[model samples]
Target: MRHYYIYLLKPEIASNYFGKEWLIYQLFVEGETAKKDLRTIAQKQINYISGTIPTLQIKKNLDKALRIRNDFYVLKEHYYIDIKALESKAVLKDHGNMLTISASGSYQAETVFFEVLRQINPAFFAMDFENRNYGWLNPVKQVNYI
Candidate 1:
């Protein structure tokens, strides 16, 4: 079943990787939420099945990091449609949980997610990849547990 899982980024990693003291990734996964899958998804920003990230967030800085920048823009409208679908379903709660991003929140969770991707300098991202020890550790929250 598809659900949400919150992975807390390690403090130092959060600082160095995302330039933030505290960062959490609340991911929507359809299968078993493995750290490996989370790391891969977070690192690549590409959809697990479709192998693509939403194109709207890409900019010059992030563009430089992508191997195929042109590929992103091809499906820009599809993602917005997906977001609208999510909004219609009320998949992202707007009221109860402060931790959850509201459907109408100025900073959508997906934006923060991609922003985290953009925050890392290409050089640092490359060096860190060599270590194979990413910051996405144990999940702090899971819908099943909660």
Candidate 2:
């Protein structure tokens, strides 16, 4: 089976465009064959999923995320999985991986949920006392990269 890497938009960046509930983005094949480069593969996947962005306002938000000029910001993390594994998990659909738990109902959800436990807020939150440990107290912005 072919090996692949699925890159997901960071939750913070995605929240700006999609909102809090959205998590996984799509599947991107790891290697190059023929003339298709990795960047080309990424762009193709992005264009395919672009359909999910309906409103001009949301599109503008997505564009803002892209403008950061960091591939790390745009597509922050990746998962390495084999084709057979993905197929068995039922996440492989129409050449893309359906990333959400409701969409896939598979192991991907477990992976994401586990990561959320470690995530800290990007900015300070004055409303909650828990903020003392996560947001401002933590000098480094915590994001899900696992």
Candidate 3:
């Protein structure tokens, strides 16, 4: 299931990634949420599935060292859509570029996701998952048997 997030961004940043015409609107919606990070999640899943990270060939330990230049959980609308679809008169109907672009809280959401892809290490993500899921590490509570 895809989760949608609506966020507001500065007009300046919005114009940078989108365009001047898209500046009027401040609300942006997108489905780009991952636990810890997409890279980490992907890495862990890949390792668990393959029992190794050689196929992924990503740095399993140097993830944090590789800083996230853009954002960790940012959103972008144009990722799944193409320019042709945006410019199609029939597709857009009577609307102008108004529906074409909405300002995300950050301009480099896609960039960040891509960067994470490059920096993710499977060994790091695929660790001790039996006791913990995405949200938090749930330590086994001792009952202190009498």
- Any runs in candidate 3 off by more than 4 Å, and if so which? 1-65, 68-104, 118-146
Q: Per-residue lDDT of 44-68 in model 1, one digit per residue for the tens?
A: 4313211222233333334454334
Q: What is the lDDT of candidate 3?
A: 0.25
Q: What is the C-alpha lDDT profile of model 3 across 1-146, one tens digit per residue? A: 11222122232333333423222121110111344566465544332322222322222322343334222221231222112322311110101211112223332332232233334321111111222212101111233458
Error of 3 at 30 (Å): 19
- How much lDDT does each candidate structure score? 0.29, 0.29, 0.25
In model 2, the Cα lDDT at residue 6 comes to 25
Task: Give the Å error, residue 53, model 1.
Answer: 17
**Candidate 2, 1-146: lDDT as tens digits:** 11222223333443443322222222222222324676687666554443331223322433443344322122232222122444322111122322221123344432332233123222211111122111211123345677
What number of clashing residue pairs does each candidate have, in the order they appear? 0, 0, 0
Error of 2 at 51 (Å): 24
Cα lDDT over the full model 1 = 0.29
In model 3, what lDDT does residue 50 have? 28
Measured with C-alpha atoms, the lDDT of residue 66 in candidate 3 is: 32
TM-scores of all predicted structures: 0.19, 0.19, 0.16
